[model samples]
Target chain A: MNKKTPKSYENMLEVKNLKTYFLTDAGIVKAVDGISFSLRQGETLGIVGESGCGKSVTNLSIMRLIPSPPGKIVDGQIIFEGTDILALPENELRNIRGNKISMVFQDPMTSLNPFLRISTQMIETIRIHQDISKKEALAKSIEMLKLVGIPAAEERIFNYPHQFSGGMRQRVMIAMALSCEAKILIADEPTTALDVTIQAQILELIQKLSKKLNTSVILITHDLGVVAGMCENVCVMYAGKIVEKAKTDDLYKQPAHPYTFGLIQSVPRLDKAKDGKLFSIEGQPPNVIDLPPCCPFHPRCHKVMDICRNQYPPTVDLGNSHEVSCWLYAEHKELADA
Target chain B: MTKYIIRRLLGIIPTLLIIITLSFFIVRVAPGGPFDTEKKLPEVVMRNIEAKYHLDEPLVVQYGRYMFDVLRGDLGPSFRYKDHDVNFYIFQSLPNSMILGVIAISISIIFGISSGMLAAVKQNTWVDYLSMALAVVGISVPLFVIAPVLQYVFAMQLGWLPTSGWFTNGDGWQTILLPAVTLAFADFATIARLTRSSMLDTLRSDYIRTAKAKGMRSSSIIFKHAMKGSMLPIVSYLGPAFAGIITGSVVVEQVFRIPGLGKFFVQSSFNRDYTLIVGVVIVYSVILVIMNFIVDVVYSLLDPRITYK
Candidate 1:
């Protein structure tokens, strides 16, 4: 299925109808089933989803870093800088990995090599994508570390990862991710593992660094608060598909899809009365390995209609760059057109 | 680090003392005496031999005498090999055994690590299967069986290399080859299996994925990132494995007829040569203690988080 989107120079990265599937012993797992989105230059796009909704898979696909044998991008176009990254050779993709597009992972404790010192990891990452001397790379590494608010970075650089605390390790990861001056940074749940206070600090650091470097970012997370605070645009995903996409403010103000609406309402609000019963989305996420032919969310959707069970909903643009994929919107669109 | 090494060295003294005390008593308690041969010597001749070595004295006196000689850096005379002292036999034969042990261990580590890495990197493929299959064979079959089979194939049938006997001169490696291979075969398999499993675990670690995300080459990731962590298990194993291999050489020595400490050890045990038995045991204990100490030091080096305190 060719679902290619027209190339746009204004956008730094456009993932057009990407499908990353895992051929496991049980069955085929549609981890990222035909999701599409674009990031404009210097913009932060948040992909908010529950566990196993394929948010992380989408980012891995963009980097072509998915482990094979069990996983493969069955079809897609990852257009970056007007070139389809999916079609590029392995060697060419390697150059883009940390050079033009870098990533920060969730668990900072395991992300940095334990045997290597902080300086070694950061300097090596810098030298991989740039032609620079070891001394120059070391200087740049320490500079990046200091920029991330790390104290005593010059001395700390010589210490192994185990010497760093959880917050400090995340800072180092960020420094390494940004050391190459990448154009787009993909952070997969970067703050999920930190404390609430540290989470806010890490988010602020990422935001400040991205703005300073003028680098686009794809921040994958399940916390709406993080998205609302740091991201300019947000994509709400469910069962490996984008169910809602809008400006962060618009998404918080008016969630179109039932899933997105349920997610927002589930969050404990301070303004609400002190009630024991919190709003929760009923039913579990559908098994991606054996997903239904129709809309995967129909089983759990509160406002499910007749067509929702028999057919997949088409994505409908609701003007002002807001989009929703739900039968309710589809029906509304039909009535409006008629 | 130097303090740690010194502390570990000092600890070996009491350890060695305890080992020596136990082995001394245990050997004395066993049924046979040093002069109890099938062809008995005259009673007067036997008495003279026992008296010369202070064996006729009371057990407590004999123990004190032995300890005194040991403190004076003397292992006493061998009862079996007359006119030769215990130290003479040990010093004469230890170098050959050390050469064999070193060669065997080196071969085992090099082959084991490489094969294990290949198996892990190509998991579930033919290379992995073949290497694991060979490793299973190596581990299951006894070294005695391997020794004869190798000698039969390479020496008797093929006639490519000498069957036994070590030579110190140039190109003596040919004579050392079969015995060393036989001695190392099982350990090689053990290390290979250990490395493969450890490497598989290391390869799956999040840091390896992080390395890949950094655009580091696969070779660099495997060698620099995965290797150091994976080596922890192998290093721990090598300490005891080194001592085991040295003692295990007794069987290989018999099969190959190579003159080494293993040959002396077996002969001394059978002949009830008290001084010789204790001397060899002490030497083996020293090697073992030092090796384990070295392994601990290497462990800290591989993983910097480990400190001596």
Candidate 2:
């Protein structure tokens, strides 16, 4: 990347050869295979994929947020701001979390404590990594709520989670996540559980906050439209690997990988010809617990080669910050070989 | 909430009536009368004794009379405790029992909840092991055993506290410590175990994870998020447990030589003191009812999901 890159950008996060596996009772499940990516400062790197495609797991690995016993990062280098966070001590990792980085989860209803008023939850979080008094914490919380575009912030702070709608609860979650002014915000499908209008509002809030704070974001979602609308850089994940990465416009214009093309085509496009059929990717994603020996997506790739069935394709550069892992481009054979 | 509470209040009628009727019959059928003794007395004297107490009457008539007396705020005289009315004996002993119960419940709840939470947060550590070990001991060792052992260790061997009685005199609270601790020992154990398990469950909730994700401190997550959520189960256990504590273990009272209600209860039971035994049973039943009612109310308060009805 350094050899070919223009020198105007600095990466906020760089994850290399990250493998997060779950030591389940049945077998070892490689939730995140050997995946590598870099997010530049203030960039919205959208990780778009189906459920079980390891997008969420990748974000969790970056945050060191995986619940252990079953889930473990067996091998990885999650370098945030020149520090390998995976190797950091527990105490230091905690400081990095919610200080340098914060995460917003899905299901706002279950995510927020129903018994507690929003003020109590938000203020306590402010006080955790800050030495502020209760009054200061409270003020900061209200400020955050206002920043998230919550109306009547002062009155809403005292309301319980049940009193708020799903959209409002999610806004509150986003507010709490942003309260620490984290450098990298990992929002795992933050709006998936809300209505479409609310989803738009939450995405807009996230986009506005990212710009305002200059926070690099890893937006993990399965919706291609979400990635298209909000993210500048998109990582198309399939079965625990990033199969394609590029500038969103370039990828949408000319998808290099067969899987990426299939994903984009599968969605109902308004620009499609009248009576044009919606494309569908055939077959379910390969089961992680007992996956095949070759490329996990080979069975469903439209441009599957003989080699694709037996050997995994190394990522190939399509030039100008675009990369695709596929055997379709023969001229890039040397890149795959390397 | 008012409707729910009113419905629960209405439930108490059948509960009390059943307890009264059961106590009446069970006390009567327990193989001995209050007048039973080894020495024989003159026939006329025995008849007079039986007639005065209405002991010679039919069982149904006796039950009716007992219910009437209870309704009229009279529990009758203690046939065994020569000089005292049953109410007098109960009133004399109730305060000491309540004190023991309150102290025991308070200590148990505070220590148990705090320790359980610590154990959950710092799970698999020494603190967790220590708290769990205490729970195991509390559950396995009966109060009868714990009371005597505590008395011997704290009173006789250590000499740090008094050995027996509710008070040094009739009013001063100087000598009640040993007995209170003895009576409370098992209650503490039960509460600790319940609190620990409930806290463990609460700590595992998704909301707790969410709180942590929000950058909430471990202390706040445990106290505000987990502890409050765990209260419903602990509250449910509290009612029955509180009644158990207030009733005072008869064996513990005897071991500590405390002239509490538990001591009176044992004496009455042994001598087949019909009116006294019946009176004690009725009093215990009422305590159980009131405690359960309180538990229901507390349950509704702690969990909005629960309704008293």
Candidate 3:
């Protein structure tokens, strides 16, 4: 067990060797398999993956929000501010959930209770963690609405969720998430359900607010473009495992893992030739329930080798905090040893 | 909102008029007359009886006369009772039936809601299975069977309560209990099933997940968040269920020997008391319409997304 924190020692949250699985009647589905990452205070980490690649599951496990019976955190350690959140009692965990660590979900249309007024929802959230009267909490809610650039915040606060548009509802969601001055916020594809124009506005709001509040953020999305624009560091996930991780600029400059390279190439770029066709990775992501014995991506890897079919590749550091799991890296390791 | 309520109220007038017209003709069209008896009277005596009540008038004229009298707050003479008019008999018997109905509905709501919520919260478990199984029994068995079974158990065998009759003094509650419980069981089953299914759906809603993510206590999430959303179906069910209970109380009233409107309604129908039957039908229809109107109002209250407009 590596119990040591990195020497920099300013991490706000650390997820260590987290393994979340679902016990379906068919079989066990390994949704999150031994993923680890550290978030420095005020840092933004983007987890980029295709759909069903465990990006959302990882974030849910961090918040301990996975539904049981089918979904369970098989093993994990979520250390938030040096406390093991999984080990905390439910009552104590409640304090950390929406207070220290808040979350914004994918669909703003369904996230807010349609029966309740926006002001009531916001004020209740405020009062849940803070010792404040309804009037004070209401004032705070209006202030949050104003902060999120909702026009006529005072009047709009009295309106229900159905009355708000998609972008405006998302703004309300963000306002609620930030109302408690949380130290960390997990946004699970927060702008996926909105228009392209509104997506930019929401992304800007999240980035600007995180910077202002100095709140660490874990932004999970499938869009690499979103990661490129917003994240400082990015982790590329495939088949419930992190295959490549690097500083965003370095990742864009020279992706080491085959999967990461394929992802980068797949994006249609303005700099590329107008007549050239866009690149796409062939083959589907591996089945999580019955993954191949060796490297999970070997079946789809363009750079596959005999070793990739025989055994799982170990994660190798490629210097400058960039790491990748691939037999190509293992060949480098063997050469270095020789 | 006021306009909506006014519109709903106005809609009931035509509805009641239709109900009154239909019931009036149907009762008259039936073969027996209110004056008929086992021992046949002389033809002249029968003619005088028919003329006294204006029964000899044409059907349309009779209906028009009845409507006019009703507009003046007159539910005409009860042939079976002879001394009291239909209005006097109904008003006298209504309070007992109302008390019984209110008690039965209250019992159903309290127990039904709790059991339903429990079943939903403990879904696919013994609690859910048992409550649903009980609900199936309640629905499958008729209230007539339930009334007798309850009478036998609580009244005959246990001897804890009186077997039949309404005591107007202090012990009136005891007399109503067996009948009320009998009436409540079927509605309880209906309400429980409706609530369980609706609550299960509400609990699974994304907003419930949001509530959980907000770190709300489980009780608050269930009651404050899920309960209100779940109530829309139950509220809608209550309007019809209330009317069903009142009309369906006939057998229970007979079984318990309670002098409620249901008993009088049954006797009037048997004795061919035209005015009394018509009077009861009109009252029941009005109650049904008003109950449904109230349900719509409550529906809007529970769900801010719903507007009458």
Best by DockQ: 1
Model 2 lDDT tens row, A103-208: 8888888888877789988887777788999999999999999998889999989988888899999999889988988899999999999999889999999999
Interface Cα RMSD per model, in Å?
A: 0.8, 2.3, 0.9
Please compute DockQ, using alpha carbons, for every candidate against the native two-chain complex: 0.70, 0.42, 0.64
How far out, in Å, is residue B88 in model 1? 2.2
lDDT of 1 by residue, A1-338 (tens): 55455666899998888999999999999999999999999999999999999999999899888988789999878999988999988778888888889999999999998998988888889988899999999999999999999999899999999998898999999999999999999999998888888998999999999999999999999999889999999999988899999999999999999999999998888777476778899999999987877888988988987777877888898988999998787766573453
Candidate 1 segments whose C-alpha is farther than 4 A from its true place: A1-7, A305-310, A332-338, B37-58, B168-173, B246-248
How accurate locally, in lDDT, is each candidate?
Answer: 0.90, 0.81, 0.89
Better of 1 and 2 by lDDT: 1
Alpha-carbon shift of residue A135 in model 1 (angstroms): 1.4
Highest-lDDT candidate: 1
| Candidate 1 chain B lowest-lDDT run of ten | B164-173
- Model 1, position A129: C-alpha lDDT score: 86
Best-to-worst lDDT order: 1, 3, 2
TM-score to true structure, per model: 0.93, 0.85, 0.91
Residue-wise C-alpha lDDT for candidate 1, range B1-309, written one tens digit per residue: 889899999999999889988889999988999899789899999999888888889988988888888878898888889877999988887887888888898999999999999999999999999999989999999988898899999999999988887786444669899989988889899999999999999998889988888888888889989999999999999998898666547888788776678877778889898889998998899889999999999999999989896
TM-score of chain A of each: 0.96, 0.94, 0.95
- What lDDT tens digits, residue by residue, belong to model 3 across residues B110-213? 98999999999999999999999989988899988888888889988999998888877455568988888888888899999999999999988888887887
